[model samples]
Target: MLTRLTPTPPARAPVLPTMGLMLVLPITASGGSLGELKGMSLEELADLQVSIVSKRPERLADSAAAVYVLTEEDIRRSGYTSIPALLRLVPGFSVARMDSAEWAITARGFNGRFANKLLVMIDGRSVYTPLFSGVFWESFDTLLEDIERIEVIRGPGASSWGANAVNGVVNVITKHAGRTEGTLVSGYAGDRERGLAGRQGGAIGETGYLRLYAKHEDRLPQKGLADGSDKDDLSGDRVGFRGDWDLTPADNLSLWGDLFSVDSHDPWIDGSDLMLQWEHARDSGAGDTLRISHDRFEMETATSTDDASIREDLDTFEVEYRHRFAPVRRHDLNLGLGYRWYRSLIEGSEVRAADPAERSFELFSAFVQDEIALVPDRWYLTLGTKLEHNDFTGFEIQPSLRARWNPRPDSTLWAAISRAARTPSRGEYDLVGVSTVVAASPDTQWMPLIARFTGEDRMNSERLIAYELGYRWRPAPVLGIDLALFHNDYDQLRTLEYSDLRLELDPSPRWILSVTPDNLLKGRTYGLDLVVDWRPGASWRLQAWYSLMGMDLNPVSGSTDPEGVALAGRYPRQQAGLRVGVDPRHDLELDLYLRFVDQLPDFDVDAYGELDARLAWRLDPRLTLALVGRNLLSPSHLEYGVETLGSTPHEIAREILLRVEFTY
Candidate 1:
């Protein structure tokens, strides 16, 4: 069993407006600006609404899963410049810096450069790559101010999000165009970061709004372990626009698009991405929504040696439709259908190449969920299932059941059982690479030997059965605590197996060794997560979290792989974080954060603690200044990596950033 902790209200409450207008409107008593909402009471904040679990708006306290919501206030007060850095605030999430532009992030366990089990989406656009089943975190960016909230689910979300959501899900929802009706300019400069950004928005007509934004940034290189040298510098720019319109009282439509490009050194890389999306919604007793999107991404990379190069072009188109309604008084029903088409063109050096070079696939899925109100909200049962078909995996199914019991108005308990799967990726099917070269066996005379790795066509999907339980309690109006535990059983995991070895007498006399991928690994993982939020008063707030995890992996019958088993438990066994926010004056705010991560024994990484601080001053309603210091506990340190991937690991250094913003 695995466990996850989520901050939820102790009792069922009325759903609030998605814009958070109800929570912010009351703050006008102090000031008429958004900043006044910082003093909202804990009770009011707990009543905030969320929709990640069931795809229907509901009070956070009523949610049954281990969910966490990061509001815009949290993002601004944290003073984090990147989305990956902000994720460190979430409990049960492991975030590590692999290099200047790469991150190793995962939930529960199985942390690595390609954390394939997690699913990530930005405003309905899936960012996970089908080629490698991982995300390129550096390729995505957004104006932090334009973000509404980020909903993170620590446990399996396959019942609602489909395959690849075996570990967790991250949904980043941006603010509606109408909410950003203003002109804003922001700039930042630091030891490693320099950027300028601006956005212009206004009413298109009586019932419509539009916003356009652009940004450019340059990042200094990081230092390597051998010597301090500039090796991973990067520069990038992006432009985007969004529009929203209310065609009628019951109908609304939204359109948005973005284009971006980035250049990097070390293994010189040039990449570009273009995306477009359109969505429509109508309220006819129940809600009906439809969305369509298209995205194109291209990347080219070359090693410093110039002997190796790789180019990839990927294009995707997706469509989704969802409906929510009440078939009866006691049951709420939600159903959705989705389809996606993906095409990829890949070219690489002799060391690594794909069989066909060009490939395409399609995926179709449908999901349905029903929520039953047992005993009039005191007890509830939710059941959901997802069925999907893909070119690789003919058919797959994910199912889940959850039960919630509210014994008291200020306390709740929940339990869930779910099934999820991680389907094979393009790399697991057509990839071919050179493993290594070595001398022939003792039996042979003096002959060089070569080992080659190839993908298996009969590869099957990895499966997971997860069990979870959680409790949320508000001991006092000013304090809240959440605890969760989970256990997961995984099977049919991928592993390398020796296929055959033979003597070749072709052009040159040498021995050939062959290896292929197979489903030969099994594992079990369990963990506990705890979170606490305390609001001592109107002027101060504190948040803390702790997580513990353990994993045991074994090879099935006739299979042996000690290295794979060791790699399964490479993440930290214990992790914790603390954050404090204080308002010293009406115009000044201070924040301090502390984080501790246990050592990664498998990677020979020592445990480390870090401290970060931020101070901000509001010159006026339209102008603000802030200074932030990160990794302040040390001058420089390594957070992740033995460089399994070609690039060398670099140490993260202490740095300070100053930023200013103006709005009209």
Candidate 2:
């Protein structure tokens, strides 16, 4: 299962000769068709509201952050069955597939399977693992049709979300039980994926509603380097229930839970979670909320040769309370308190091992934020801070300041400065052993060389200071634009160093190289993101975005590592996407998307372009059928590699899927 980890030279970039013309033609063709289509107006889309910025609902155009919202209509039209694939529409996010079930997703930069800088949550429950500070996307099997929207914030969110929210935050919100009041049956089959789902919902009482759903999916393996070989396949099942009750005129109660199991070629995973929440509101823009949740996840993985196997089990419990009110004539305030407990166990026969097989930790946090209006309706400022205490990092403080100005009725300008941190994980503090083994010389008689990685107890948290500026402009009822720029400075980054080398002959003659982690790296990054949305006529909508990024890294005065410098350029420098939505008739809809990703020189990944299309026909108000084609421009291509897990990266091939939906 292991493969050599080495830096390869960059290959020639892929060519798409007509890509530029293809993008331009859509905008030009829409100029004369604006009044002919019957669809949502641009003004309605511009007024979409999001809640991730300050934990309070606000218009997306007025937020003081780089934010994007994927609405329910956008999700249905795009025909994406997974969250990771849906995120590709965001302007600054980096989404890549590693295998049949695993994905690497991040915002801005620092993209990897174990990307520790991003925080993800479903509703109010955190999904990031405490073991590695990353998410296992395969375990998130919620029904896509039940999702209401996804909010993406591409900047430091620690001031509100606490630690490990350095680069970004993603919040996936689902619809209320009351919104779905009937029976729904959905199924889809394709060259690569097949799944079936059913849901039943009804009124529980005069003021209560409940819904229950179950789903199962089987995914075919990915294409390998050689012909006819396939990577690991995946299958999984999930069941969930949700309930909502209006306890009184001003009080509400909500309960939800999910249970799931996944079986794959190399791993088996199972998990369950439950959540309860209550809220009380007053007419004067004041409210109090309480939430409590628990989650448990277990995984078992082994190699094909059966020489090594690993098992992991994790459980987490969390409680939170918050209140919001207007404290003064022109000022609003919000405060919250949270507590979490985590327990984990690991057992395995592998190259790396943890010293303490079972361990537990606790986290306590509190935060406060205030928004003040400088002018009646034109200018505003917000300030917030969070204090947290945890086992890995004793105590840490995060703060942010933001300002927004509305010079015109349809435009907004905003800026922000923030501080965030990435706390140490179990693997960074307790792991030790031979990470890899390789031949020391061409001759087999020579002793094999081993790279031994050892953890350090004195590790410090990685920190970042970020500055951001953004603007949103709506020139007419048919078009809108958004722009964002950011600069980040990093400190106390992690790097590996060789401490010792020796020959061991007790078991067998071999060379052991001792490697240790240190806080000896410093770096800076800057990037820009731009998005445009236009509706030429009532029948067509066009959306496009472009992003640019650059990074610089160096070792401290007393440290030196050439490899660390090369790793800094592991992300793409440029990326762009174009999407067109059209309705030729009242019952027919079509969507086309094109994307281009720049080369990753350090990872030996070449630049490439992708095309996806979808068409749907509404036979009646209660039934619909759709067809989707992905990666239509090429037969196969590679998106990423997983060197740390010693797994070979596979190729993504063209695929087609047909779906049928019925509701009553």
Candidate 3:
């Protein structure tokens, strides 16, 4: 029911905080005397490995990238239920709650519900939507206890992950079925949210394992600004199954799927998917993998018109194969090929429609990466590139070069340079005459003004050239520090420009301000992230981090655009956090998390501070109890606002929850 409370990372081992892994304090508790506590040992920290950076496992201390891990121990004590909420614990990530269910998450900069530069995966499956190359955080849910670890890379990952992996990459890896071979039930209820989940797992004849789970959640709405009315309520139900089989000592197979229905506003978002993966390993890490999957999602969303809605359906099919082997001594090589197909259908009220009504698209991609040990284990270099062809863009290329050096057994220094791109979304290539915005027409003496735009066929992909540097040091057994710095140059950013103006008499003489999306925006961003972990003794641990960032975006010479103020103010300039984990008596645990987020001038959202506290007690080996209080510093506060996906902005109320857990 609880983790151990002893042993700190030994000397000569610096804890990698990248929970963006910008920061993570791996403290766990279950009651013990002060004399019996200790931080993680140096040997343990050095042995920790992560797989997101290069698609293969490597020691966190030896990797050539700024990466971090959030182990299962961190999740159980955080008192967070959703993946998005748990992300707040990561050092460099910006996780803003737009409303009760909607969220805006990003790393480094550019935060929005539709932020396109970040790529996220669950069990090696991408959750990015082709509609906008962004994730719908509201619908991205899972059983938190099943997670093994979350690996986060805070910089460009295009080299190995392909297009749209410009800002960062997140991989949520779940535990193997064999590790969860038991019955578990967990449930919680609070003023703002409540949910229940249960799982049953068992073993197959000789070498197979299986698990099945079901869960449901309901969330009440936030109070509106004008009238303080209830809005933004959300609810969802989900069921999933997983099976793993070992056919032989060297061959394995896994199949998994999930079905879900989430409702918000007036319409319900529904989806289902299944994945099959088979692998055969010839030698240590030398192997071949084949994967195939199918996914479908359908939903109806409100249109600009007072009573109209846009109904859309999408189906996707993908297949991929990969091979990893040591081609030459001290050199590790990896190669992969992938193909995907998408079928999309859109229907709308008589007022508007998709340009082509129905469409089908294909995508083909391949990537290769190699790692070379310059000197046995003291220095290393890596190079990789990806080539992709898609319906929106004919072809795109991404490449990266990285190097790492162990200046001393106690310290590591690394650097990298990478090129990446974000291709156009379906709306940027196919939508036409859509009702986008409505405003007051001052020219018409305050009459209604409508804005509509058509997709531009000549639009180009947004691109980035990123440079980064990092260092890690373990000065003593009780202290560890990690730092990262980055600068990014962006080109061909998305822009909406004035195209035409029309006056329509049929709709009572209104003005129409027509526009088209373009690539007339370019800019640069730079930032630094720092994290520190310290353990004074076995029962006391503290973790802290701070981030500083700056953005300068300007319109190119040939574009008619809106003022660029909002563009630059979309993200915060500074963020800092502190977490304390304490186990005063064996079987009792206490955690305190405090944070400060700078203001977003673009949205007129002011800077704010908050706190979350969690207390847990172990009654016996099979049952545990916890009380969690969130946003405790204030009764309510607005986290984010303005012009990204939703119409209403509501203040998030303080919350308190009581949770219970049982296992057999």
Candidate 4:
């Protein structure tokens, strides 16, 4: 298991002798700060906010993509204690807990241990691994409070983000140092879980600010076999710091870094990983910005049945520059260039029966986007492309075009077409020797395939062509709706093929082996997204969304895996969720949320629904109390499916968590 925690010297209380200066802090200005922000009308919010994921400054409601903005208020009101649970609210996204800490999250289809479609980032650092082409959700943990907002784009973003942005993009942004300028301490111990966190932030000078935080938690036990058997336990810790300086009124610089390590055991396996990252941003002349970052991640795992283990390490560096050009009235122009390099190494022990291997690669790209106003305030068109090159694949180009029509102040319609790609992971292009078997002759020995670089060098990138259409409307002060439709065509999918294996005897017999990464399957995916928000009154708020998806592969073709079998993508046809919040009085708040997911194929988990609710009372400005309930429909329900070779289908463990949160 892997966890996030902070490891630093004990926190010391801040000494503030200026009693009259307390009111000068922006943080102490009011109690309804976030609530007041959320109460703003759709039009008000639209004009006050800008999103970066769009590559151009656009109002949340005016953007052409199907996007969702999860604010800090949403996190505070959600009864769920974990980050994964928070993700369930996003339409088209499927999030399930595999164990105490592991999670499986994807968009559209083919979600698994190696979900190769989605792209995730924190600030601007990509979290996808080169070893498996997927993210280890468990290893990505942070102090939820530090998050400013999460921007989720539900369709292809390859034109701007490059390969692996085929399905969706999730960007998590953190608050600036100026927003956190006080001492905060929190500690909690609940049924099966215990944790403590501390933060200290203040101004270093008139123009400089810094914040540091550390946290640790213990995992609880889960029932296995549906018989209350304690089969698994999880735990972890994390620590990090962020700082920023104002070099001038128009120029600013920022630096952020963190270190995390996790270790645990009990379920079917145990594992540990260490992650570190550093990022810098600088503003130059005339609306120009530059960013550079570096990251290192390492993880290892051991199974209960064997002493063998698998180890993986990855290192990556990226640099980006953005220039914004000013022009007459409605004209906006932007240009950007980025470079990324990745290296990975994996080792497997004898018990794992897998191969050991090492691989490294680099990807480079430059992009440009320009926004033109057709009718000052009524129409706009945005166009962009990414010209990229990689070691495994030669030069590649991805382009996108979008047009937005805003006939009225509160309504918009948009359409776009884009291209995206997915490069092969180390597992797809490499192999390793697993075991040794004795026979009558040395030539007759048998060995398992481990992860190793094979000399064949035969692999191609998977590509996608996407089309999207969308509409947004705000007919009244309290009602808003957004809808989007998309279609995708996939090609050059990488599939493994069966090859002959040859063995030889010292005196007479001999055998040969064969393998190939051939083009096997073509896939198509189409879907619809609908989001509705209604604020019936100042005290009551409601939000709901529904997603319908359909995916298919040309299975009539031949086999692609070593078993010579065709595999179909697995995902539910429909997923829906609803959330309601009510402030009965100024001091009392209540929230209810419900999520429904259609059963996913390839796994036996049947369709299920989860209901969660929370009640809170503001005892005073400094203290609050909350009672939370999760999985209220069932004490425990099957949330995920797991399968092993030659074994029966089983469900992941599920239980209830009683959590209490306090802030001062």
Off by over 4 Å in 3: 1-43, 303-307, 350-352, 433-447, 506-508, 536-538, 563-565
* C-alpha TM-score for every candidate: 0.91, 0.92, 0.92, 0.85
Off by over 4 Å in 1: 1-34, 37-40, 266-284, 305-307, 435-451, 498-513, 560-562, 643-646
TM-score of 2: 0.92
lDDT (Cα) of model 3: 0.80
- Which digits, one per residue and each the tens of the lDDT, describe model 4 over residues 1-664? 0111222322333343432433232111112233443455566656645454455556787777777777767776775545666788787797876656666788866665567888888776787877667877766767776777778888888777888888888888777766666665544444545666677777777766788888776766555545555534566677787777766655667777777776645212222222222222323323666777777787776454445556777778888876666654676777778888877777665444223366678888888877789887888888888789988777788888988999998898999898888887666666433222233354444433222223235677888998999999988978988899999888877665545555545444434344455557677889898988898776888989999988877632665354212224246788999999889888778888888988765666778888888887665444345666666787566665663211122244333343333333
TM-score of 1: 0.91
Q: Which scores higher on lDDT, 2 or 3?
A: 2
Candidate 1, residues 1-664, lDDT tens digits: the string is 0011111212222342322532221110011243554744667656777777777777677778888888877887888877888898898899998777778887978777777899898886788988768787777678777887889899899999999988888988887777776666666778888777778877776777788988877878778776778567778788888887776666677787888887765333333334444333433357777888888888776565443566778888898888887457889899999999999988886777788899999999999999899877699999999999999978999999988998987777999999999999998898777644776666565666777768777989999999999998889999988898999999998777764568878766687777777889999999999999999887789989999999988888876444668765468999999999998988788999999999988777889999999997776554456888999999987777673343566788898988654455
TM value for model 3: 0.92
lDDT string for model 3 (22-105, tens) is 112111122222232234554466568777888877888776677877777678778987999989998988888877778889
Predicted structure with the largest lDDT when compared to the true one: 2
lDDT of 1 at 608: 95
lDDT of 2 by residue, 504-529 (tens): 88677888888777789989989999
